[model samples]
Target: MALGGGTFTTMNKILPGTYINFVSAPRASAALSDRGIAAMPAEFDWGPEGAVFAVESGEFEKRSLELFGYPYTHEKLKGLRDLFRNIRKGYFYRLNTGGEPAKNDFATALHPGTRGNSLRIVIEAAEASTEETPVYDVSTWMDDTRIDLQTVKTAAQLHDNAFVRFQAEATLAATAGANLTGGTDGAAGDAAYQTFLDQIEPYTFHALGCLSDKPAVKALFTAFTKRMRDESGVKFQTVLHRYGQADYEGVISVENGLTGAADDTSAVWWTTGAQAGCAVNKSLTNRVYDGEFEIDTRYTQAQLEEGIQSGGFLLHRVGDETRVLTDINTFVSATEERSSDFGSNQTIRVLDQIGNDIAALFNTKYNGQVPNDAAGRVSLWNDIVRHHQQLQTLRAIQTFEPENVTVEAGDTKKSVVVTDRVTPVNAMEQLYMVCVVA
Candidate 1:
């Protein structure tokens, strides 16, 4: 029999050369994860179809044309621009894929949408090439701006650019320019939004945005969020418009919408990003709205207070600037398991951070690697305490006690039971100062 050199699970083998298991106990493994990510499922006239793509803030400005099929300043990207103002990274899904891609004799547009119709290809004869082996200069343009330039001897030598894919079998020809045509956007229905929700489930984001104003669509997003947060342990908040009936900590209901030409759009996009980008120790209450939308903020003081009682996340004009009325979610009813403090978004963020961080610490440091022994349980307890100390120092949580956390073997040998408690901190939202007459 061959010598058993691999790691041992039960240590029962008779003939074993070396049965060793490697486990990591790095201190850095328990560090808290960053939280500036958001997810959005929206209809785009142009972009990838049937996929979730990540867009980084650092590259959104430079790669706007390539990624979204529009320039950075285009009106089509106004909502995304507002969203990106706060978030660092976003996972976006283009919910429409029912259109035909534009195509010409030389190449086809990379994606389907009306924007592809603006793509044009220009081919010119190079100066230093023989008639038998002619060289050509190809320029890819979106209207007046040339996006890609290539020099090729034949169609076979051309490769796909950002805007279009080359036709390797077509003969090269020189003309003014060939514009891509016949691009169309397929209609986006409920099924498309469902597809987006199904695909975006695996991603970890702090906030999700529902841009649709339809009640049914909002309800779909609301249900999906509750299932993910309650059943799957995925911690995040979903921002919706005019749907306070969700009444869940995982949902933020935007009561006020904007007017003007962008009536369909609302502050939900900005709030989604803001809620995601907000630090766990901070709050968005009274935060000024610095977005591009002309928000509807004509509510009176009584209306604002009433909206808060109804768990409405609304905005109102304070002086000349619009500010958030309250940083809260649609969590009106309190249960035995949850209290009114859960309505505060800052409190929610801290709780979410602790849950996510401790889970990460356990999964990365102790899961499957550490044996279910007293020593292993103690090691896990220490790491959890250290992580909580960091949170306490950061003011995300207050007065964390290491003795409050307990780790023990679960009902089975493969299971580890951990019980932890955290008191999340909330920012001040009210003032009750009185003046004494002298």
Candidate 2:
């Protein structure tokens, strides 16, 4: 039935059901440190009705599935309904493995039934601003959150295991005084040489670097660090774009950061955000907007050699090793193959309890006790059957409508002209009440 000329909204709700996890054979590895991996559990969050509500803003959050309100058996109904919906959205279907037309199908060389189904239908639902607000009952701000064609994995593991690094170089233009030779236009040039010597006098005699020579090394290292930072930024941005396009959004945290080292005349000074022997450059770690991000090691052979050769470098082994692991939650197509066909044939035995009622009516109304003889009883049974069939046929005819066809209307603005006409009632010799013709 179609309702006309108004915004028609439907609220489909699926009642919640208990969820169970089955691990047929559970196993764990001792060598995998203290960390462990587990499969993402399947969930069912049905609302008041049979419709499955989308998960919002929590651990599972956007990583939930959506289902229709109708109670569908695994085989006959759910798949068929999904197929029909796809067809309505212009997705031409082909037969799948079990000989049913599927929306997500392609004819591959090896398996001619597989295809990439990317067509989507965007529904405008209302999102809840708070827990008290009813989301399913509204019609604005809600977006589709289900991930498609991706596998699920945990992001916490990735944050722990991913590598990261940081480095920086000097801004020489801002640093104070080295040689300002080109600034002055002096005579003979000896005075300029003398001025240079005076400027170098402050630290020229020091064991490592005169204060004047320090700027050169700082500038080089700073530039190098800046380049590394830029590269890291680009790589992270690319990952964010890809994940967002795939409909995955989450926070990314990097651990164990690296701040660039400084080179001195006698040794290299690696900036340690933490104290000596603690993790260095830890503050470089940050919470990123993408689902995945990385941390890395930053070092240069030339810088290391320069520090070692100058007797400032100390050789010490890294006593502790921190392992990193990464995980991601992606959406992938899964089938619930509990039974090839889920529906069963039901036999509905509807015995008529109308015998007494019919007999009584006949006895009272027709002034008959209802004959008890075999032939008479047989005739009564036939009469009952005839009445039942007539009522059924009348009902069917009342409810069923033939396909519509266009017809001309002479004067009426609205009229229903059914092509298959019903017999008109003849009133010429019918009940005659006292009446006057206008």
Candidate 3:
């Protein structure tokens, strides 16, 4: 008889391999889970249509040109370049509600946009020593350079390339070049943004950047942010332009746009990327705005203060350079009893780190394997304490007391309850000095 090896939930899980709870946490509770991912849906002239894609740090330039037909530093990609400058990575989805791809007899463009028109295919006969068999050299070219080349006896032997696919059943013939044509960029509409929201639902990201200034678009992003954080336990922040009344801690409303720019909403790109990219232990308060874009500093001191009070991410003139005033999110409605502690992004980062690390630890190491009893609870508590201790060591948090942590039996035998407190550290943004004179 074969030794039975499969997952089981019953008390008698004989022939043990591994029994697992495939069910993910319903929501991120105070007990477990952490957060630090960001997502954005934006309209672009080129890129994969109707899909979410990931771009890692330092890969922005290469990936942008491959997907969007523009280099990171190109004028067409200023917003994207700004974003990558701050954030280490990003999850991007292009909005192409009505775009169309360029096509030819041989193949079609990978994405539907005007940039696809730049693609060209070149075919030539391969050199052969003997006249017994003939070979063809196929090349996929974009702009001036060949991106892909294949040597095959027939078209049937050709494999699909990253830029385009080969036409099945078409007779192969030598051609100097065949440039793709008829690609068009569609108008970015509200439905396009909505489609982006739907497509990016299953993803985890640290922040969502809104490029649109339309009130409706901003409202859609805000509602999505609130719903994801409160209902789904998928915690993240959203950054937008001039959305001062967002009022929630999860939303960051930038108050100013870059001056001397064709696109007024350009600054939001860098700010959103920076907010998402900021390390768990760091704060953006007074962080230097080193982006290529120039801030529109038309507001006076009084106006700037009022803007902060109303939950606006403002850039201030510090001598000759511009600096972020305070890294506070939109939490102007905070009261004394429920202060704007959540307003500080640093506090959120620490809490999010703790929640994420603990959840991962439990899911990977302890879930279902350890018995759900007092000893098991103690083990879990110890692990949690150690996690907090690491954060404390990193100076991400302070004043962690072991006694403050408590894990106990829940209302049900299978459930557990945990309570803990932490003091998140914030970067020093202000200094008060008193000078004594003799």
Candidate 4:
């Protein structure tokens, strides 16, 4: 007789010693896991020329110089600095379709763009005390300071550094400097932006920032966001400048950009990042705008009100401070009977968080592991109740009654059906008071 101790879908008539199956308990997904990630596409001078790159907090300055050929504070990086003012992490993809790389005698620019034209390489004799059997001191310079150095005996021994790659099979020579030239920035077009959209499809981020004011580009982002959210179950919003009457919950249209600035649409960068960084249970209404750009307060009181009614995100002066009037998307209620709950960004955040968390929990813990029976259904229901209870405790939702949740048999044997209701909580944004004095 043979002993069996393995998993089987059906029982077999054979000698068996203990057939056991183990499954872990389902746990709630963490709400903070995917909060602060943002994505954007822009023209850059140095960095990965045509790919999606991840930049963590506090690394923008160093990475920008290492990849883009300039520090974050350089004039060329103004837009990126604005974008990173509030966001701690981001996914940046460059949109340079026909750009040219700067080159010199020893090496070529790692990426194409006008900024790389500033690169210069200098070769000197290495100090005798240095390690690695120093033969030559090869320095890569950007602007003034040396960014990278290498010691080698011959040109063939030289290796590529962070700034540039060395040329192949070149004769060794010492020169004061070799200046790179002819780098150019590509002409930005609709096709370049479309390529960005296609490359970013498989990524996950909380918000996407579109700085272009072109109507065609803005429409592209709107349609891409809708398809991703509706068909693919990926939920993320887009922030664009002056995109009037988009009327979609996933699109945040900025009515007013920065005033007294070279780039009028710079406000979109900060707004997009701030929205991505907002907490799950919080609202961005009344949040102070502390970015580098100045708010445009040209709207009168009536115009401001009209902007809000038409689903625009605006900042107005409030006692020497500029603050957001409401953190709302472009979702206008189509009918009197329809609820305007979807217009509030806080409501959407709560709902999206719930949907993402529950789906992740089920797919990871309970998929194909639990039987489609009363016991398994009850187990699932209990886990869901606990998850909602946690949300209620955190004040993200209210009135989550256990009895309102039900798990029943689906139309097929291997399917299960679940239905539940939830009321999202929003922060108090207005108050009316009456006082009488004698």
Candidate 5:
């Protein structure tokens, strides 16, 4: 619908992580109507899937048909739908194995075309203006940041079952081999240990970042640092920080790796020396590593909240019954009243009110209210839980990783591993980052 006035413009847009707003004062026009239908609209709702506008118009009605007495319809922003659709699908961190352009990998692999990698918006005035309704416009653009395969691989390693086992076995083997005397002969255990390390080479993390924002970056840094501290098994001080400016700046790094012998080369040699870095490390916490992700930073606080709210992306293990976390923030926030029969009952009631479609899926509800039975023996309830988790992951990535980098060149050397600040659960869109001892 059109808002009537002498001649004016105002608009606002909300991108994934940022918001932009604009307005124009009423202008003076030579032509004036005695009954000038001046209107200012505040907001408009178009259902759940439709775009809602909270506008302040000079002359408009919330449900006005036409100020000029002609039929009118609001202009549908095709780009908005396109952008939101991509956001809903979320971004992926695919291992660019083909050696093509990484940007192309990101652009093409994550749903080719239609503003998937980056976003651009424009706000411009249409025609003449005066003192009263001065022409006005507003525009904004938001994009997702990108990291390298190493980052994704490393982060994934934290959750990788096989990789964790391999690292554990390798650490023990290396330790045992170190105690063995003489070069006369190496036992099978030594060989096996070395093999384990070799196998781990391809799965190592080499880069790190928020995958989009500083907060995400901080969360990952905190999580990994804590994990390393708990598992490093070494006794040494630790430190991490950033340096530099402009495009050339990156994270600083310095950490020691454990060695089997004194004369042997240092096992922990990583990017060190203040080189305008993002994070740092000192001493080798533990050459041996385990699988544990942490979230202890204000930056990651929202992320952790989002991650938890997103429903954990996947139901790792589901039995006949599962404790589905309806609201992770509330669940975690609670001290003694997190999960209540009353609360659970209320939630199920709301779901039931919505329809039997949902109620049919859940049986044996947690509070003895909602059903907990898996329909038709297919575990439909569990499936729905898993779906919500995936949805949560997608939403988290979209909300937190709006500042993703788009690596256009996918060549091997050009594909320098970087850290993904955010981790989308999607296999392809998941950000891969490396931790270069930084």
Candidate 6:
């Protein structure tokens, strides 16, 4: 059997769990894994409802209308544009799906949202249509742009497309256009966000963001993150707005607000994307804010310092541009088991990478397939060592030694026990120098 795949609590156990190793503080951190995936529940004018939909970074600009029911530059997609600026791929769940779909006599909108109101269907005789054989050209248009065109002899031949579902039983008629109406966006409530969490549980992402400013909603995300990380061994941090009181490593509380928008909590989206996309070797400290929203970086020097001490992920004005004050998660209360290093998001990234990668390797390569013998153990050891070596080369970890890893048979012949060590590296954030005058 594979390891239970979670942090070790007690040595006494009927079932094997995460391996533990004790070493002196003097010595030195995981696989090399890819990053840049983020997840969040978003409110949209039009999109898939009640399920998570994936959007690639490159697809946002070109296929924006098809995927999201709006052009790339549409005002409704501003938040998505801000998020996709950093993330490679995003798992988005539409929080509002209870609205009625816009419909005319001939067709109905595919999804329920206000954007569907812009849809119009134009039907006319095709060039091939003659007295002997008649066919009509049916076209779906969003504003002035003709998106889909189909030639069919009768309405019965019509089928549902991405944008709309045709009325198969309606008689074919030629008209200027029939605009879909009555479309409306549903209100997102606490239950909608809860539905998002339930649906997104199986997805693998580097970061998750809570766009809601409600204390109850933020608390829900915090609890979900902690459960996923500690119990399920799913490693990812949740970004929150003004939720530093969470005091958990699995959460990054954004201290600053946003400008030019009614919702100040929207800035959390940018940080979520940035944190997810950041390399395992890197940190967001002092990184320039290139997102569309203007962050409120108004804070005195002492306040900024105090913010860091309290584990607030803040942005500050640097020259004419805004930049991150320092990269940190809301884990101010560090204990012996979990050291102060865990407070740094960079450190957590490295550690999470290790836990995730090693668990994946064990589950895929060694679980049930390999015998718990000496040769199999050596092979497992080799793979882990190579994974750590790659991370060390990437500077995500430092001073990694292959000998630090030890793999052995567990109490049962079907199980295995492995204990490893790693030293995670953090980005340089501060420097001090002394000038001597002779």
- Candidate 6 — what's its lDDT? 0.88
Candidate whose TM-score is highest: 1
lDDT of 4 by residue, 1-438 (tens): 567677656677376577766777656443334577789998776667567889886888667778556777777676667677667788988876578888987888887778778888888877662455547788889898788888777777778877777886766567899998888888777888888999999987888999897989999999999999889888888999988667888899987766775347888888888888887788999999887666787778999889888899988889888889988989886567546888888988887777777777678767898898999888888877887888888899999899878999899998889998899999998899989897
**Which ten-residue region of model 5 has the weakest summed lDDT?**
33-42
How would you order the candidates by TM-score, starting with the best? 1, 6, 4, 3, 5, 2
lDDT of each: 0.89, 0.20, 0.80, 0.81, 0.22, 0.88
lDDT of 2 at 368: 46
lDDT of 3 by residue, 1-438 (tens): 566665567768667455555667433222433333457777777787777888876677666677667756678877777787777668887775578888787778877888889898888888851357778888999888688898887778888876777787767777999988998988877888888888887886788998898999999999988998878777678998888788988899888876765348877887888888888888888888888787887789899889888888888888888888889888878787758888888888777677656766777767778889989998888888877877787899899988879999889988889999888998987789999998
Among all windows of 10 consecutive residues in model 1, the one with the lowest summed lDDT is 257-266
Score every model by TM-score. 0.92, 0.12, 0.85, 0.89, 0.13, 0.90
Candidate 5: regions farther than 4 A off: 1-202, 206-213, 232-438
Backbone steric clashes in candidate 1, count = 0
* Residue 154 of model 1, lDDT score: 87
Q: In candidate 4, which residue pairs get closer than 3 Å at backbone N, Cα or C atoms, i.e. clash?
A: 46-67, 46-68, 47-67, 47-68
What is the TM-score of candidate 3? 0.85
How much does candidate 1 score in TM-score?
0.92
Using lDDT as the measure, what is the rank order of every candidate, best first? 1, 6, 4, 3, 5, 2
- What RMSD, rounded to one decimal, does every model reach? 3.9, 41.3, 5.8, 3.6, 33.2, 9.8
By the lDDT metric, which is better: model 1 or model 2?
1
- Angstrom error at residue 4, model 1: 21
